[model samples]
Target: MSDSLSEAWDFLTQAAAEQDDGCRIPGRSWVPPILEDLVLAARNTSLSRYYPFTSHARLRFSTGPESWIGNGDDLAVGIALVPEGRYLVCTQASHDAPVFVRLETADADEAAAMAEHLVNAGS
Candidate 1:
């Protein structure tokens, strides 16, 4: 893994360790393999190459009363990256939720292109 990717993984593992409460917290094992592959795909994109912090992101684990769209009281794991601006890659930690990315004021077209690349790579 690249240095940035390794740093991201370290941050995630640290977060998991610190936030371990008795409940099911998502650690490295909880992350789906495809999500990591998607992250790798995102890192290799030209758009990511321009940003120094593309893969150097923070990982968060939330388990509270915060209302989620589809997840109710389930653990949430989110990877927040500041590429052009800020984008979040999130999924329910314990549930079979689909991993999705939310971009802020960054390049929407670039995000779309990256998603397309991920899909193509998967196929």
Candidate 2:
């Protein structure tokens, strides 16, 4: 970790320690498991529900390049942090052999790109 990152962590720790829980409550942080870059880059990612029962918001890392997991049953999305500072996040309607595309993409538009790469990579 860089000095900046460590400093940021320290600041967050201090703030969290001194903060008051007046209106909203905090939940456990979600950390991903270790995996190869390609494996993580190719996963079906999405904003995991923050708490136990809500879909009101999403985590940005979940929308960028990070590893996420799901049962391939519900609506989903995935993100892969690009080496060049860019990123890729994709979605699929189903988890069948070839995840059906509700959307399509190559690499430019990161807004709503689905898993079009899966056709060549899913094997």
In model 1, the clashing pairs are none
Q: Residues 76-120, candidate 1, lDDT per residue (tens digit)?
A: 334454433344544443446666654332443444354444433
Each prediction's whole-model lDDT (CA) = 0.38, 0.29
The alpha-carbon lDDT assigned to residue 81 of candidate 1 equals 45
- Tens digits of lDDT, candidate 2, 1-123: 222423433443343333322212334322112112222222233222211111212112222221234312233544433334333454444445343223323343433224323322541
For candidate 2, give the lDDT.
Answer: 0.29
For every model shown, the clashing-pair count is: 0, 5
lDDT of 1: 0.38
Q: After superposition on all CA atoms, what RMSD does each candidate show versus the true structure?
A: 14.4, 15.5
